[model samples]
Target: MSVQSESVTDTGPEQTVGYTLHGNRYLNITNRCTLRCAFCPRFNDEWTVQEYPLRLRRDPSFEEIVLAVGNPEEYQEIVFCGLGEPTLRLYTLLEVATRLRPHARRIRINTDGLANFVYGRDVTPDMEGLIDALSISLNAQNAEIYNRHCRPKLPGSYEAMLDFVKVAREFVPDITLTAIDGLSGVNIPACKKIAQELGVKFRRRVLDVVG
Candidate 1:
């Protein structure tokens, strides 16, 4: 099911289909999300990375996405990410991942850790073999902080996110808890401790570079 790129142009969002950075390819499927963090780039900026507008004009079709991937073998990894939360397009993500698994050395999902809330069931099992790693945006060290920083759409999203991670460990082979490195009031050390407690990896991403 892996996609193979024919000699497509490497410049412009339209030509690249799935956008590329360094050597990694990213799929930009939708412009929908359940959260509106104050620092989220999609809310404030043009949402382009390296002159590639991540703000997709419309949702890409399955065929379009596969074609966008071009040659998945060219990158070290293929990631599900963009202006929107990847889980909102759950089946699409899995379908694309299934399509890319064979050609991609690694496949990762950068997510808000609310797939369970989005689909109202455990979506982790769907990714068992398709995804190589999961990067869950922890955002804050505690519920209060999460509410302030993440600004989730649903009540108890913070608790639900933690619950998502706990279950993710059972199905998703690898998980990484990440927070913006310098978000005001967010204690990076405490976030690391939370990841340590969960027995997963931790990462501190720079807010300015998230796009």
Candidate 2:
């Protein structure tokens, strides 16, 4: 089931609903998140990602998001990414992705892998055929280190995220677990090993780098 959250109206014309990076068109739907990572730009009082301001005064509607992607075929991939977790606005993400499926070469989402814990259900099935790739933030080697850096808002988030990966693979085809390399206490090799053990791919992300 989709999350029933309040709608935030777009009050101005200057709000950045979309941005382009590395041949990919990215969508900024909402600013809500399930985790407050110590290294996240927003948490550090920085709102810009690669010089594009991502502080959303209000979340965009499905129509607004669709309008932001003027030509889906112009980019290599259509990515649902911003300073926040895309899954928090799962309904809007799915609606926009579904609308762009025919024209886009690929559709991807950068997330924290906590949708199931947030929605309290197996939401991966809803991503079938709509999303082509998932880049999940693994962040740490173990729950203690994960909790220290991610500072997840919900209980059992570390375990829930792992569970999401296990279940998500059955629906989404390209799933990669990612962990930041430079953060204190973050062991890159161990993190990659966990992803290997989980039967998924892994990536080492640099601190403060978007995409």
Candidate 3:
């Protein structure tokens, strides 16, 4: 509901459609999400990610999102990330990625991996050509730990997330399961083992580091 931007140029005093960090361009498409994670900055009344205020008055339009990028080739990767889950605006994300594909080096989505559950269908195939990689938040090793941290709205969300990953593997070429290493009861090694079992890459993220 509040609009603010310091890192990237604010668009029409409404929201920040894009921001840069660590050579990557991040798209803040929507502020809605499927899970309410306790560790999320927004949930703690902090909306800035790496100094860029991400609380959106409303989701940006396709044209605004593209305009925010300026030039896709300038960054190492174009990432769909923000204070919210990128997949919550699936069509917009796909459309933007499609438009940027020819010029951008790579396009990735940082997600909570609950698209299938939310949409009630397998939507992974839709990302086949547009998305270059997926950084899914595995969050915790098991359902109990996951529920405690992520606090997904729907029942069986933990299983649903894993199911989404399995189906997503056939479409997206690169998939990496990530978990915050410092979170209580989050076993980094066990999380990595899940990624190994799934035959995907794994990344151990820090507590407050974005991107």
Which candidate's lDDT is highest?
3
lDDT per model vs. reference: 0.80, 0.86, 0.89
| Number of clashes recorded per candidate | 2, 0, 0
Ranking by lDDT: 3, 2, 1
Off by over 4 Å in 3: 1-7
| Model 1 ranges off by over 4 Å | 1-17
lDDT of 3 by residue, 61-179 (tens): 88888888879999999999867988989998889888999999999999999999999999999999889999999999999999999999998999999999999999999999999
lDDT of 1 by residue, 133-153 (tens): 999999999989888987899
Per-model TM-score on C-alpha atoms = 0.90, 0.93, 0.95
Q: What is the lDDT of candidate 1?
A: 0.80
Give the Å shift of residue 47 in candidate 1.
2.1
Candidate 3: give the clashing pairs: none
lDDT of 2 at 206: 84
Q: On residues 34-83, what C-alpha lDDT tens digit does candidate 2 reach at each position?
A: 99988888888888777666788888889888887878998898889877
How does residue 85 of candidate 3 score in lDDT? 87
